[model samples]
Target: MKSTLNKTDEVNGTIVIELEKADYQENVDKSLNQFRQRANIPGFRQGKVPKSLIQKLYGKAVKADEINKIVTDEVGNFIRDNKLKILGEPLPDNSDEKLVDLENDEILKFYFDVALTPEFDLPLDKSVELTCHKVLLEENLLDEQMDAYKKNYGTYLSVEDEAKDTDLIKGTLTELSDSEDKDNLQVIENAILMPSYIKDEEIKSSFTGSKAGDKVVFNPKKAYDNNEAEIASLLQTTKDKVKNIDSDFSLEIKEVTRYQEAEMNQELFDRVLGEGVVTTEEEFRTRIKSELEKQFKPNADHLFIHEARDIIVEKMKEVKFPDEFLKRWLLETGENRTSEQVEDDYPKILEDLKFHIAKQKIAEENNISVEFADIEALAAEVAKAQFAQYGMTNLPADVLQNYTKSMLEKEETVQNLYDKATEDKIIDWLKENVTVIEKEISSKEFNDLMNERTRLQEEN
Candidate 1:
């Protein structure tokens, strides 16, 4: 068998596979023999069918299968042997070939179209400069975090004073009678409500400053803005049942629970920062500022990578791609798009494709790789970050392990974790070799910069 690649240019080519009769004749015979052993005929026992009769019965089908196998193997071998950098999977050649005369000809030929990766020079040195911002923890941000930690660790205390908006009110809700019969009222015992969460300001204020045993009448539908879940929970009924409830209900306050921030003592310190991490209030505040700074690293790294990508894309704008082949590929590969639609969407696709090409080249040049452990570690990190978003920091290791394990069980999640791990490793390497200019900026300024960046992208 002889196979060869005919290239029109750097980004387009055709692979021609020529298969000799000898290459497939043996397999055809083996297949025929197997068929003969399994054949059931009217006047012949199994395994007693003659080879000539078998060939006559199944010769063309066996020949076609053998030729297909040979052509596929030959095409693949040619690509691997030549180390061809391909853009997408090879497609059947556009021009149809008439079938080879299987009975007389001793050779069969097949043709396939292929797209090659665009050639471009990659720079992985200090020449690529990026400005990275150091987010300074402002006083208000730190204070907010401190307040959150204190409140999150706080306990609810029963108060005899009037109920505030932030206080949790425990009460019994009863449907008020429209007529003079008070005995016909429907009641729910031990209902819970927080005045601050009530949607209507007028209704929320009515409950505010109400002491124990104080009864307030309000329409449940208006108080919660017709929120089905809230109304159902308030009346201890199902959402389906809430649809018909349009009456005013009386909520008699049974108990008012006020939440107070935890004191900055040794126990609070131990709980917030782990045991013995900090001893005093000053130490705790300082450590919190530092922790906030560390927490912002992922955001900073994201911006840095974006900066590098913008620079790289601008520098490689003149590089050419195989427009014809790419357009054809977009139309194929299970995408339900017309040629015109593909043309309209091709620019954005090309931009991302160019960046991916650059990233892959850098990874290949540096021998960067992602192992299973890398994926697992990234999963754990992501789980922790999500937990921290909810202010549940420093979770037990076993709990994190369980989350990571569950995440890896999903195919999509595993793919995302793999991508995140690869990006992190590549960025880490880039920071060491690239020129990263660090500049301190306030959180507000950083946010404004991000907003401006987003605006510019939208305009483009």
Candidate 2:
């Protein structure tokens, strides 16, 4: 068997494989002999069937299979040995091959079309400019974070004053009727309501100054904007029965509960920052500010990376690609993708492909790589962030390690983390090479920048 790569252009080529009868005849004969040994014809005993009969029955099929296997293996070996940088798998060129007389043909020929990777130069230097926006921890932002923590650890307290919008009101609901007959009135005990959640302003205002044992008459359906769910819950009935409740209901206020934020004391500090991390209010605030700075660094780095990518893309805008070949590849390989869909999505796909190629080239030139240890570290960080969302920041080392290990056991998770690590390494390399101008801005300004970026992307 012999294979040769014929270059059609810098980005396209054809691989021609030539197979002589000697290349496949031996394997075909060996397969036929094996088939004869396993033959189960009724007229012949096992291992006693004639070779001539077996050859006549399966000769062409066996020969074709052997030739295909040889051609495939030779094509792959040729590509690998030559260090060919191809885009997608080689596709068979059926148009170049004619019907062969397998019974008498001594040499078989096959053709395959391939797309080669395009080459370009992207040199990273101080010429590339980027801005890294450092988000300053504004007092408002810190106060907001502190307030959230206090609310999470807050307690509910009973009050004897009038019901406020933020207060939870408990009462007994008694349906009122104009007629003297009050035996069939609907009575609901321990009904709960919050003025803040009331849909009607008039009804909500009526409960503002109502203290304990004060009775306020209001229509449940109107107060909740005729919502069946809310009315049913307040009246202790199903949605189907809420429609029958048309009379006004009197709510006798039993108790008003107000939520009070946890005090800035030793216990609060211990619960929030882990035991003994902070002893006083000043220390707690300082530690929280420090934590905010640490958290904000990643956001600044993310923006820096985003800006760097844009600069790279704009610089490499003139790089060429095999447009027709890639479109064909996408249509053929993508599952259930129509030509119209591929055409519509090709621009974005091409942009992403260009960035991917650029990243590969940069990694190769810089000797940057993602190791197993890097992925493990990233996985551990991810687990810590997830746990921290639920206020479990100070976890045991073994617990975090076990969670990270479980995540790495999943193939999809490992692949995702590996990709993230690779991108992160490349970003680090970019930061080292490019000119990054660091500017400190307030949190609101940083948020505005991010929001504007998102808005522009959505518009495009």
lDDT string, candidate 2, 2-60, tens digits: 88999888889989888888888888889898899898988999999888888888888
**lDDT values for all models:** 0.86, 0.85
RMSD of each: 5.0, 5.8
lDDT at position 394, candidate 2: 69
User: For model 1, how does the per-residue alpha-carbon lDDT over 233-347 read when each residue is reduced to its tens digit?
Assistant: 8888899988987899998889999997888788888887678988989998998888777677788888998888888788779988887888888899745799888888899
Clashes of 2: 0
Mark the regions of model 2 whose C-alpha exceeds 4 Å error after superposition.
33-42, 45-48, 97-104, 154-262, 265-267, 290-302, 455-460
**Which window of ten consecutive residues has the lowest lDDT sum in model 2?**
94-103
- Return the top candidate by lDDT: 1
Reference-based lDDT, residue 182, model 2: 84
